[model samples]
Target: MSSAHELTQEQSDRYWQDGFLFPLSVFSEDEAAEFRAELEQVEKDWLAADLPLPLNTYKRVNAHLVIPLAARIAQDKRILDTVEGVLGPDIMIWSAEFFIKEPQTKQTVGMHQDLTYWGMGETPDQVTAWIALSPATVQSGCMDFVRGSHKNPILPHTDTYSETNLLSRGQEVAVDVSEDDKTHIELKPGQMSLHHGLTIHGSGPNASNDRRIGLAIRYLSPGAQQLVADRDYAMLARGSDAHSNFVPVQAPDALFSPEALALYEQVRLDQSKALAEGADSAVPLYTKM
Candidate 1:
């Protein structure tokens, strides 16, 4: 894999200006196809299960085991190089999520910074690599971002659905922003978009006939700390001693090889220690609007 040290000056500058960047063909078509097959198998297994689904089933419904195909892509030299360039040498696979937009599904995500969900401190170092496992188009609810929103103050967020919608989990309503200022991100299979953790973004509902699936891999800088007292979400340290609270999911080993695993284990241990020390001093990063 190429080292993060090799990013061109232009690539680095673009990321700083745009708050997001799309790198073409990060994965080969063949590699994407294999991962899609694995995802399908997982979905089938979930459907055949007899137990009642969890309350957070929509978020936890997808299986996250690092299939061999995905593992290979996660370790791709080019990806590692770019991510390292943005986040620095020491990093951890913070989390991975499968965003599956079913056809005709009217579930739109509200415009908000990722840190709003993560509950981490405001720092420009964190990065998220969102890979398109299938063709992602505007019709299929492709992602949208406020071009320079990363430079703006973090906005309040709310649930994407209305009170009438069945999936409402009482998520905060997103702050209003102008549509004219947003940029749509459309990608073909194998392409990926990398964004800052504080970038203001969201997606529309899938109105197309096919499913729009994206695998988002989140990365944290080496020194990022975790807040343990916060029960609603996991927070990563970035600025001062404050952290942002985001939903914490189990780390998947498939995404990390032996070398990555070693780094992840060390970070996990350190995070545990920090949580233990600050067990009684957790604070909210934002207030309700």
Candidate 2:
């Protein structure tokens, strides 16, 4: 195995100061391609099952439970070490989502704070590790952050529900973000970026000829609580979940196995309920089986 990635003290400190850090090398380009190939196969299967293909596919939700590769990737020792530097040793993977923009598409992620759409508690204890599966350039909609914006309280937002908007509620921050203050978090395949939950960020439509793909894996300390009045689920990605604050999830061995699907359904439903409970804006309807 290759050497795992770890944050230098400078990198970790810079993350807290700027609210985001990028280009953390995790896997080799060849390894990233392998993962991307696996995901392509998963997408094919999803299409065969008549699942949604456009936008950030909900197939990415709790994907570790449904897709074996995603599971293993989430538990990667290097990733855990990187996250540990920011969130400590006791970590739980609260969520995972795929942000994929096809070549020359108008699918843009609206500028918004993640907590606006997430019901995962008031404290900003979560960090999302965005692992790039393909090159993410400015033209390809690489996410950019408003430097130091994470220091502010959660800002007011509006739900546009635009068809091409990639937020859960199509939400955008109500306050104006200074264009000059933005930090474009560009990355090559196999690189990753970590951003705080309260960080103001979003991406534009992919105008380039290449696809942009990223796996956003959200990690939180065990002590983080759900803001909603409903139970939530998370996989204990590393260390012990001493608080028992969330329902536990186990890794799966096959793609969409019956056991995995059943667990995923239960967790997603509970999470969706929490999302609905705390949401002040309109939520996109999720089709239940």
Candidate models: Cα lDDT each: 0.59, 0.81
Error of 1 at 4 (Å): 11
Model 1 lDDT tens row, 207-277: 99988888877767644544432332222222222233334333345532454344433433433332233
**TM-score of each candidate structure, all chains considered together:** 0.71, 0.92
Give the total clashing residue pairs for model 2: 0
lDDT of 1 at 61: 19
Clashing pairs in 2: none
Clashes of each: 19, 0
**Model 1 regions more than 4 Å off:** 1-6, 50-76, 159-174, 228-289
Candidate 2 per-residue lDDT, tens place, 7-108, comes to 778988999998898879988999999999988887776665743322224444666777787778888998998998899889998877777889999999
